[model samples]
Target chain A: MSTFLLILITGIGLGALYFLVASGLSLIYGLMGVLNFAHGAFLTIGAFTGLWIATKVFPNPTTWTFIFSMFAGGIAAGLFALLMEQLVITRLYNRHIDQALVTVGVSLVVTALLGGWFGFDARFLPTPLWFTKAATIGDAIIPVDRFIYIGVAAILLIAMLSILKFTRIGLIIRAGVENRSMVTALGINVRLAFSTVFFIGGFAAGVGGVLISVFSYGVSPLMGGSWLIYGFIVVVVGGMGSIAGSAIAAMLIGITNQFANYYVTGLGDFVVVIILAAVLLTKPTGLLGKVSH
Target chain B: MLRWKYSRPLLIAITVIFAILPFAGDNPLSKAGLQQTMAVAFLFGALALTYDLLFGFTGLLSFGHALYFASGMYVTAILINDFNVNFLLAILIAVIFTSLLAVLTGGAALRTTGITFAMVTLAFGQAGHVVIARDFGGFTNGDDGLPVNADRLPDFFIGVVNTKYLYLLALGILVFIYFTAWWITESSAGRVFAALRDNEQRVSVLGLNPNRFKLLSFVLSAAMAALIGAAMLIVSGSGSPRYAAADITIALLLMVILGGPVTRWGAVLGGIIYSVLSTRLTVLSDGTAFDSLPNFIGGPLAEPAFTLGLIFILIVMFAPGGISGAYYRARFKYLNKGK
Candidate 1:
C-alpha cells in the first residue's frame, strides 16, 4: 500500500511536468493548426538560461534566487518564441506544413547550437537543499520535490483556466479555436492572437524546462526532446486545445507509466504506446477534442 | 515538358558516370575513404527517393518512416547473426515482415489527416525506437548496437579491399529503387496517387477509395525504405538504434525538401548532396580549419547540424521549390531570352 502511494505521488509529479508542456502545445495547436516542433527548443532554451542565471549570475543560489532564475528562464523563452513567431511563422502564414518544417529546422539549429556551446554533456542544476529531502506520509516516503511540482502545476492550471474563463484575450483565443474564419470575419486581429499563443506556450514550456531540470537533477541539450514527445502524447490523448483534458490525460499516462515500469521493468513505454494506439483508433479526436473540419 | 524531354538521357548519363566512378584512376573519388562516403550517399539517395514516393508524390507527410527502415536493418542483422540464415534470405524475410508492419501501422495512422496523422505516425515510430533501444527479448543487443556477423557473409562483401563491391552494390540498389519509383509514378496507379495528393474528395466522388490508394503508397514506400535499410546494413556492416530514431525520418524529409519534393531526381540529388556534405563537414570540423577563427563563430561552424539546419531554414523560407525548381526557373528564363 505504501509502495502504491509512493508510486502514485511520483506519477502525479511526472504528470505535472507533462501538463506544463502540453497546455501550451494544445492551445497553440488548437488556434494555429501547427504541431509546433520548435516547442522543445523553447524548453531547452529556458533550461539553459535558468542554469546560466543560477550558476553564473546568482552564484550559489538560495530558494528565492532559484525561483527568480526559473521565472527569468520563462521570460527568456517567451521572448524567443515571440521572435520566432514574427520572423518565421508569420511569413509562412497559412502554410501549415511549411511552418512545421521551419520549426523542425529551428529546433535542430537550437539543439545543435546548445550542444556546440555547452558540449553534449549533462550539466547539473543547483537546487535548494530542501528539494533533496523526503517527507513521510502514512508509511509512504515522498520526495519533497514532488510536492513542489504538483503545487506549481496545480497553480498554473488554475490560473490558465481562470484566464480562459474571464479574460478578453482568452475569449478571443477560444473563439479563434472554435471557428478561425468566423473570428477573423468578425474583425479581430487573429495574427496578434497567434503571437500571444506562441509566447504563452513558450513561457509555459520554459517553466516546464526548469521544473523538469529539477526533477531529473540535471540539464542536457537533448533533455527537451524526450519530454516533448511525452507532451505531444499528452496533448493528443487529452484532446488538442483542452487544458482540462490535458491534465487528465497526463495523469493517466504518468500513473500508467509508473505502475507498469514498477511491475514489468521496461514495459512502461510500450504500454503507453499501446494506450496511444488504442486512443487514436477508438477516439481519434481525443477525449475532449471537437471534430475538426 | 522540357524536363521530360531531357530526363531520360540525363538519367542514363548520370548512371554511367556513377557506374565507372570506382574505376576513376588516381583520383580521390576511387579511394577507400571517399568510396565508403559515396556508398552511404547512394544508400541515402535510395532512402530519400522512397520518402519522396510518400511525401512528394502521394502528398503524405509521414513522420515515422524510419520504423520500417529500422525493422529491415534489425531483422536482417538478427537473422544472419543469431539464426545463421543466409544474408539474402534474411533480407527477403525482413522485407516481407516490414511490409506487413507497415500495413498494420499505416492503416491505423491513415485514419487521421494532416497534423494528427503526423503525430500518430511519430508515436508509432517512437514506439519502435524504444523497443529496439530497450533490446526486447535481448534480440536487439540494446543501445550498444548489433554488428553484422562478417564470418557468415560472402567473399565479395567481406573487407576494406572489397569496399568497391559494396559501393557498386549501393549504387545498384539506388538504381533499382529509382527505376521502381519512376515506374510507379508514371503508371495509372501513380496518377491516382498524384490525384489523391491534389484532392482526396474528388477521388472519392469519382468512386475510388482514397484510403486504399494511400495505403498502397504507404506500404510501397515503406517496403522500398526497408530494402534500403537491408542494403545499408550490408554497406555499413552494423545496425544501430539510431536507424529507428526520428532523426533519420527528419533527415529524409530534409533531403526530399532540399531536392524538390514532387521531382523524383531531385530527391535523389538532395539525399546524395546532403549525405556527402554531412560526411565532409564532419571531416572539416575535425581538422584545424576552424581553429584559426575565434571561439564563438568557429565553435558553431564546427557543428554540421547548425550549418545544415540554417541552410534548411533558408531553403524552406526562400526557395520553397528547392534545387530542381531553381534550375527549371533559370532554364525557362534562358529559353525565353533565346526566343
Candidate 2:
C-alpha cells in the first residue's frame, strides 16, 4: 500500500514537470498551430542552463541558485525560441504541412545542435547541498529532490495559470488563440502575443529542465525525443489547447509510466506510447476535446 | 510535352538507365556504389511519394509513417529468416501486412488532422520502435537488428555476395512504385486529396468526405513505404528497430520538403540527391580532403540531432524547396525571366 503511495507521489512529482513542459507545448500549438518539435530541446537547454549555473555560477544547487538558475535558463530558452519564430515560424504561417516539415526540421536541428553542444555522453549535476538526501515514511523511501521538483513545478504552474487567467497579456493570448487575425485587426500587435507566449513556453520548459534532470540524475542528448513524445502525448490525450487538460494528461502519462515501469518489466519503455496510441485511437478528440482549430 | 511529365516512358527510361548503369560499368562503378545509391534513392522516393500523398494530397503530415516501412522490413526478415520464405513472397506478405496495420492505425489517426494527427502517428511509430527494441528474443533482436540469410538467395543472385542485383531490383521497384504514385496523384481521387489539402471544409461541402480520402491516402502511403522497406532490406540486408522510428520519418519528411512536395519527379530527385549525398558519399568514397569536408559538415557532425539542426537552418535560410526545389525554382525563373 505504501509502495503504491510512494509511487503515486513520485509520479505526481515528475508529472508536475511533465505538465509544465506539455502546457508550453499545448499553448504553442494552440497559438501557432504548429507542433513545436523543438520544445523538448528547449527543456534540455533549460536544464543544461540550470546545470551550468549550478556548476559555473553557484558551485551548489541551493534554493536560491535553483530559483535563479531556472529563470536564467528560461530567459535563454525564450530568447532562442523568439529568434526561431522570427526566422522560421514567420515563413510557416498558415501552411500547416510546411509548418510540420519546418518544425520537425527545426527539432532535428535543435537536437543536433544540443548533441554537439552537450556531446553524446550524458552530463549530470550533483544534488544541492541544502536539500536532505532522502525522505522515509514507513517502508517507503523517496528522494527529497523529487519533492522539491514537485514543489517547484507546482509553484510555476500556479504562477503561469494565474498570469494567463488574470493578466492583460493572458487575455490577448486567449484572444489570439481564438482569432489571430482579429487580434491583429484590433491593433493589438499579435506579434507581441506570439513573443510573450513563446517566452512563457520557453520559461516553463526551462524550469521543467531542473525538475526533470534531478529525477533522472543526469541529462543526455537522447532525452529530447522521449520528452517531446511524452509532452505531445500529454497534450494530445488531454486535448489540444487546454491548460487544465495538459495538467490532467501529464499526471495520467506520468503515473502510467511509473506504474508500467514497476509492473511491466521488459516492455517498460513502450507503455506510454502504447497507452497514448490507445487513447488517441479511442478518443481522437482527446480527453478535453476543446480545441477545434 | 504535358503528357511527357508523368508518362510511363519517361519513368521507364529513367528506371532503365539506373538499372542498366550498374552492369554497364566496370571496376570502381562496377562495385555497386552508384547502383546502391540510386536504389536507395528510388526506395526513399517511393517512401516520400507516400508522404506526399499524405502531405501534399490529403493535407496530413504523418510524423511516424516510417512504422509501416520498418514493419515491412521486419516482417520480410521474419519470413526469410524465421519461416524460410522467398524474397518475393516475403515482400508481398510485408506489403499486405503493412497495409492492414496502416488501416487500423490510420482509422484512428485520420480522425485528427494537422498536429494532432502527427502526434498520434508519432505515438504509434515510437510504440512500434520501443516494442521492437525491448523484445530481445522474438522480433527485433534487441537493436542488433534482425538478420536475413544470403544463403536463402540463389547463386546467380549475388550469392548474397553481390548487392548489385539488389540495387537494380530496388530501382525497378522504385520506378514501378513511382509510376503507380504518379498515376494516383493525377487521378480524380488524387484531385480530391489535393482539394482536401487546400481546404478540408470546402472539399467536404463539395460532397467529397475529407476523412475517407485521408484514410485512403494513409493506407496507400503505408503500403508504398512497406515496399520501400523491402528494397531497404534487400540493399542493406537488415532492418534495425531504429530505421522505423521517428528519426527515419524525419529523414523522409526532409526528403519530401526538399523535393517540392506535390511534384512527382521532384520527390524522386530529392530522394536521389539526399541518398547519394548522404550514403554513397560516405560509404564508397576513398578518404580525401575534399570528400572529408562534406562528411565533416554532414557526417561526423556526429549526433543525429545536429544534422537535423543544420538541415533546418539551411532549408529555412536558403533551400526552402529543398535542394531539388531550389534548383528547379531557380532554373525556371532564370529561363522565363531572361525570355
Candidate 3:
C-alpha cells in the first residue's frame, strides 16, 4: 500500500510537469493552428535560464530565489517566443506542412545552439531547504519536492482555468481557437491574440522545464527533445486545445509510465507510443479535442 | 510541359556527371575512398527520391518513414547473419517484408490526414527505435547494433570493404530507383496522387479512392526505402538502431525538401549535395582551421547538426522551393529570352 502511494505520488509529480508543457503546446496548436516543435526547446531554454539564475545570478539561493528563477525562466522563454513569432512563425500561418517543417527547423536549431553553448553535460539545480526534507504519512514517505510540484502545478492549472473562464484575454483566446476567421471578422486582431498566446505558451513551457529540471535535479540539452515527444503524445491524446483533457491525459500517461518503468525497463516510452497510435486510429481528434479532420 | 522536356535532358546530364564523378580523380579504379563516399551519396539519393514520392507527389508528410528503411536494414542483417540466408535472397525478402509492413501501417495511417498522419508515423517510428534498442536485444543487439562482416556475404562480391563493388551496386540501385520514380509520376495512378495532393475532397468527388492511391505511393516509397536500406547493409555492413531514428527521417526529408520535393532529379541532387556538405563540414569543424575562434562562437557553430539546422531554416524561410525550383526558373528565363 505504501509502495502504491509512493508510485501514485511520483506519477502525479511527473504528470504535473507534463501538464505544464502540454498545456502550452496544446494552447498554441489550438489557437495558432501550428504545433511548435520548438516548444520543447523553450523548455530546455528555460531550464538553462532558471539554472543560470539560480546558480550564477543569485548565488545565495532560497525558496524565494528558486521561485524567482522559475519566473525568470518563463519570462525569458516568453520573450524569445515573441521574437520568433514575429520573425518566423507569423508569416507561415495556414500553411500547415510548411509551418511544421519550419518549426522542426527551429527545434533543431535551438537544440543545437543549446548543445553548443552549454556542452551536453547535465547540470543540476540546487534543491531548496524546504524541498530537501521528506514527510512521512502512515508508513509512506513523501518527498517535500513531490508535494511542492503537485502544489505549484495545481495552482498553475487553476490559474489557467480561471483566466480562460473569466478573463477578457482568455475569452479572446477561446474565441480565436473556436474560429480564427470569426474572431478576425469581429475586429479582433487575431494575430495579436496569437502572439499573446504564443508568449503564454512559451512561458508555460519554460516554467514546466524549470520545474522538471528541479524535480529531477538535473537539466540537459536533450531533455527538450524527449519532453517534446511526450508533450506531443499528451496533447494529441488529450485532444488539441483542451486543457482539461491535457491534464487528465497527462496523469494517465504519468501513471502508466511510472508503472511501466517499475515493472519493465525501457517499455514505458514504447507503451506511450502504442497508446498514441491507438488513439490516432480510434480517436483521431483526441479524447476531448474537437474533431478537426 | 516544357519543364518535363527540359527535365529529361537535365536528368541525363546529371546522371552522366554522377557516373563519372569517381573516375575524375588521379586513377579511374584507385579512388576507392571517393567511390565509397559517392556510393553512400547514391544511397542517400535513393532515400530522397522515395521521400519525395510521398511528400512531393502524394502530399503526405510522414515523419517516421525511417521505420521502413530500418526494418529493411535489420531484417536483411538478421537473415544474412543469423539465418545464414544468402545475401541477395535476404535483400529480396527484406524488400517484400518491408513492403508488407508499409501496407499494414499505411492502411491505418491513411485513415487520417495531414498532421495526424505525421504524428502517427512519428509514434510508429519511435516505437521502431525503442523496440530495436530494447525489446529485441537478442535479435537486434539493441543499442549496440548488429554488424555484418565480409564473410556474411557471397564470394561474388567482397562485402562493404570492397568500395569499388559497393559503389557500382549503389549507383545501379540509384539509377533503377530514379527511373521507377519517374515512371510512377508519369502514370495514370501518379495523376491521381497529384490530384489527391491538390485537393483530397475533389478527388473524392471524382469517385476516386484517395486511400488506394495514397497506400500505393506509401508502399512504393517504403519498398524503395527498404532497397536503399539493403544496399546500406552491403555498404556499411551494420545496422544501427540509429537507422530508425527521427533524425534520420528528418535528414532524408531535408534532402528531398532542399531539392524541391516534386522534382525527382532535384531530390537526387539534394541528396548528393547534402551528404557531401554534411561529411565535409563535420570534418572541417573538427579540424584545426576554426581552433583560433572563441569557444562561444566557434564551438556551437562548428557542430554539423547546428549548421544543418540553420541551413534548413534559411531554406524554409527564403527559398521554400529549394534548388530545383531555382534551377527551373533560371532555365525558363534563359529559354524565354531567346524566344
Candidate 4:
C-alpha cells in the first residue's frame, strides 16, 4: 500500500513536470502551428543556463539563489526562442514539414553545442540549503523534493489556468489558437502573439528541466531529449493544442508510466507506444480535443 | 554541375564510384581509409536517400524513420549471432522483417496528417527504442549493441574487400532504391502525393482516397530505410539502436529539407554536404577551418541552430523552390533560350 502511494506521488510529481513542459508545447503547436522540435533543447539550454548562473553569477548559491538561476534559465530559453522565431521560425510559419525540419536543425545545433561545451557530462547544482531529506509519513518515505515538484507543478498549472481564464493576454492566446485566420483577419498583430507563444513555450521547457532534476539530480546536455519525447506524447495524445487535454493526458501518462515500470519490467515503452497508436487509430482527434484532421 | 541530372549515366557513375572508391587503396583494403570512408558514406547515402523517398516524394515528415532502420539492423545482427545465418540471407530476411514492421506502423500512422502524424510516428519509434534497450536484451545486447564480425559471412566470402564489398553492396541497394523512388515520383501515384501535398482536402473531395496512397508511400519509405539499416550493419559491422533512432532520422530530414525536398538530387547533394561539414566540424581542431567558421558566423550573430535554421528560414521565406528548384528553373530558362 505504501509502495503504491509512493508510486502515485512520484507519478504526479513527474507528471506535473511533464504538464509544465507540455502545456507550452500544446499551446505553441495549437496556436502557432510550429511543432517546435527544439522545445526540449530549450529545456537543456535552461539547465545549462541555470548551472552557469548557479556557479558563476550568484554571490551565494543558496536554494533561493538556485531558484533564481533556474528562473534565469527559463528567461534565457525564452530569449533564445524569440531569436529563433525572429530569424528562422518566422519564415516557415505555414509549412509544417519545413517548420519541423528547421527546428530539427535547431535541435541538432543546440544539442551539439551543449555536447561540445559540456562534453556529455552532467553537472548538478549543489544541494539546496534546505529540503534535502526524505520525510516519512505512515511508513511511506517521500523525498521532500518530490513534494516540492508536485507543489510547483500544481502552482504552475493553477497559475496557467488562471492566466488563460482571467488575463487579457491569455484570452488573446486562446482566441488565436481557435481562429488564427479570423484573429489576423481582424487586423490584429498575430506575429506578436507568435513571438509570445515561442517565449512561453521555451520558458516552460526550462522550468520543466529544473523540476525534473529532483529525480535525476544532474544536468546533462542530452537530458532534454527523453523528456521531449514524453512531453510530445502527452500533448499529442491529449489533442494537439488543447490545454485541458494536456493536463489530463499528463496525469494519465504519469500513472501509466509508473504502473508500467513497476509491473511490466521491459514493456513500459512498448505499452506507451501501443496506447498512443491505439489512440491515434481510434481517437484521431484525442479524447477531449476537437478532431481537426 | 554535370552531375546534376538523374540520368542513367549519372546512376552508373554513382555505382562505379561507390564500388571502386572503397577498394582504391593499398593491400588489406579492410584497413584502408578509403574503404572505411566509402562504407560510411554509402550507408549514409542510402539512409539519406531513403529519407528523401519519404520526405521528398511522399510529403510525409517523419521524425521516427530511424526506428525501421534500427529494426532491420537489429534483426540482421541477431540472426547472424544466434542462428549463424549467412550475411546475405540475414540481410534479405532483415529487409522483409523491417518492411512488415513498417507496414504495421504505417497502417496507423497514415491515419493522421501533418504534425500529429509526426508525433505518433515519433512516439512509436521511442517505444521501439525502449524495447530494444530492455526487452531484447539477449538479441540486441541492450544499449551496448551487438558486435558483428566476419563470422557472420561465409568462409569463401573472405577477401581484402570486406568493407569495400560492403560499400559496393550498399551502393547497389542505394541505386536501386533511388531509381525506384524516382520512378515512383514520376509515376501517377507520385502525382497523387504531390496533389495531396498541395491540398489534401481537395484530393479527398476529388474521390482519390489519399489514405491508401499515404500508406503506400509510408511502406515504401520504411522498406527503403530498412535497406539502409541493413547496409549500415554490413559496413559499420555492428548495430547501435541510436543509429536507427530519432537522431539520425532528424539529421537526414535536415539535409533533405535544406537541400530541396521535391528535387530528385537535392537530398543527395544536401546529404553529402551536410555530412562533410559535420565531420569536418567535430573532427577538426578549434583552430581549423570549420571549427572557427560556423561559430564565427553563427555565434557572432546569435545561437548556432540560428545559422543553419536561418538557411532554411531563407529558403522557406525567399526561395521556397530550394537549390534544385533553382537548378530546374535555370535549366528551363536555358531550354527556353534555345527554343
TM-score leader? 1
What local lDDT score does residue B107 receive in model 1, on the 0 to 100 scale? Answer: 97
Candidate 3 stretches with Cα past 4 Å from truth are A129-133, A291-293, B4-10, B13-17, B20-33, B155-161
Taking the candidates in order, what DockQ does each have? 0.74, 0.46, 0.74, 0.44
lDDT tens string, model 3, A11-111?
Answer: 88888899989998898888877878889889988899999999999987898999998999899988888888898887876776777788888888888
Find the candidate with the highest lDDT and give its number: 1
Give candidate 2's error at residue B129 in angstroms: 1.8
TM-score of each: 0.98, 0.89, 0.95, 0.90
Quote the B-chain TM-score, candidate 3.
0.93
User: Which of candidates 1 and 4 reaches a greater lDDT?
Assistant: 1
Model 4: colliding residue pairs: B66-B244
Query: What is the Cα-based lDDT of residue A278 in candidate 4?
Result: 81
* Better TM-score candidate (2, 3): 3
Taking every candidate in turn, the Cα RMSD to the unseen true structure, in Å, is 1.3, 3.5, 2.2, 3.6
Native contacts conserved, per model: 0.65, 0.60, 0.72, 0.42
Model 4 lDDT per residue over B220-272, tens place: 77777777787777677678867756777777876776677777667776766
Ranking by DockQ: 3, 1, 2, 4
Ranking by TM-score: 1, 3, 4, 2
**Worst window of 10 by summed lDDT in candidate 4 chain B:** B298-307
Error of 3 at A218 (Å): 2.7
Angstrom error at residue B5, model 3: 5.6
lDDT of 2 by residue, B1-339 (tens): 223345677767766766666667565546655555666777887777778778766768787888999999998988988889988899999999999999998998777666667788988898888877776457668678877787885554553346687776776777688778978888998888888888889988888777888888889989988988977887877788788778788777777777767777767776666666666444433344234455445343544345544665577555666655676676677667857
lDDT of 4 by residue, A57-105 (tens): 8846777887787688889988998998898888766776567666766
* Candidate 1 residue lDDT tens string, A1-293: 99999999999999999998899889988888888888999999999999999899988878998888889888998999999999999999899889889998999889888887888788999987888899999999989999988988898899888877798888998888889999999999999888888888898889889989999888898888888888989999998888898999999999999999999777888788778778987888898885363
Q: What C-alpha lDDT, on a 0 to 100 scale, does residue B148 get in candidate 2?
A: 73
